[model samples]
Target: MKVVIFETDAPLPIARAKHGSYGDMFKALLQRAPSFATAGPVEYIQLHIHADKPDGDVRDFPPLEDVDAIIITGSRSNAYDTHIPWINQLTDYVKHALAEESKTRVVGICFGHQIIGRALDLQVGPNPAGWELSLTEMALTSEGETHLTTAAKEDNKLALMQFHRDIVFPPLPENVTTLAQTDVCAVQGMHRPRKLWSVQGHPEFDTEIERELLEYAAGTGMDRKIIDAAIAKLENQETRVERDRAAVADAMAAFLLE
Candidate 1:
């Protein structure tokens, strides 16, 4: 399979040193696909959100015919930021790609999730309840179960890592389907038939990455109370839950390939 990954933000220095860029982390996540071992080989191309070009066909992204899927990586930057030129450029690209492309698939995470919402003309803004950090347990709608179960080994609630303050709200486009939700974010995940899939949490993130993120967020003025509570969840093994990361990856793989 061939994929292009768009890295939206630079990772914290420590995390980047250990995990490489956000695009690289996604490259690693591709292995979680159920067919990876038998799929022969995969091709991946990386692009930064900052690298967008104006020309359509020969712009930042490869032609849709050349790629099977496009995945947008998580970013520390807010998705609703209109002040940033690259942010607007990326959103416009997504808006056009979603409307014009039919053969290729798209997946978005966190800020990327919000990007899809913005592209679709949905409400994208900060959550009134504030930031969501650490592993968040989320529920899948019946439609979600039907779609995601095709790619999952077993069916159950999802527990994925989250580190975002922004949320994607209602008035979804005609093609969009609400897949999963949690207490803080109603749009935890969404699907658009064979074309697009997106989520507000990080399936590629682990506890260690969250640890690094918590500190980094604090340095940027995120409240310590929120970070401390999230930290406790990571430290308390008794209540700790393993994320259904592989299951999500499996679903994404099936979505991109099918």
Candidate 2:
């Protein structure tokens, strides 16, 4: 399968050294699924959206039919910020892809999730409850039970890794369905039939990378209490980090294949 990774931003220097790029982490995580063992060869194409600063443009996006799926990565930027020209460009591309008759599947993660919500005319912005970091338990809705066909099916509540402050608010698009929810965010996951699938958590993040990210956030002047909480949560054995990572990967792989 030909998969296009729409990379929104690069990892911090320290984190990148330890975990590689987000695209690299995603490739490793997706390959963990047993189905990938016999799914034949898969090709990944990384299209870095923020690489060339002043000249960046989404008009150069590849034709929809050329790839089987498109996965948009989490970004440090906010989706609701129209001041950033690239955010608008990326949102436009997503809208165009979803509106097209082609069958290309689109999966959005974190910032990507917010971007899709905005593209579909849903409210997406800062969360009133602040950032949800580390491992968080998200309860699956009836729609999730009916639509999700991977590791997420094993239980009603799945603990997945998350690191974001933005959220998709209420009054969702007419065609969208909420799949999962947490106390902090109402839209932990969502599906729009065959066109789009998105999650507010980061399936690509493992304990080690999250630890590095926490340290990075700390150095960046984030609240000390938030960073300490994330650190303590990461150290907590009850988080079951590995299991959550696998569950999200399995669900993501299944969705893309479907």
Candidate 2, superposed: residue stretches over 4 Å from native: 51-59, 146-155
Go through the candidates in order and give each one's C-alpha lDDT.
0.77, 0.81
Per-residue lDDT tens digits for candidate 1, residues 1-258, read 778898877777888899898998887776767576467777888886642332221245577777777888887677887777677877887776687645677899998889889988888998999888888877888767765553332544777788888999976777788888888788898898778899889988878888898988788897888888898877753223333676677777767766
Tens digits of per-residue lDDT for model 2, 102-193: 77788999989998898888888899998899878788889776654444456687777788989999877777889899988999988876
* Candidate 1 off by > 4 Å: 50-59, 147-156, 236-243
Against the true structure, candidate 2 has what lDDT?
0.81
lDDT of 1 at 158: 71
* TM-score of each candidate structure, all chains considered together: 0.87, 0.90
> Which candidate has the highest TM-score of all?
2
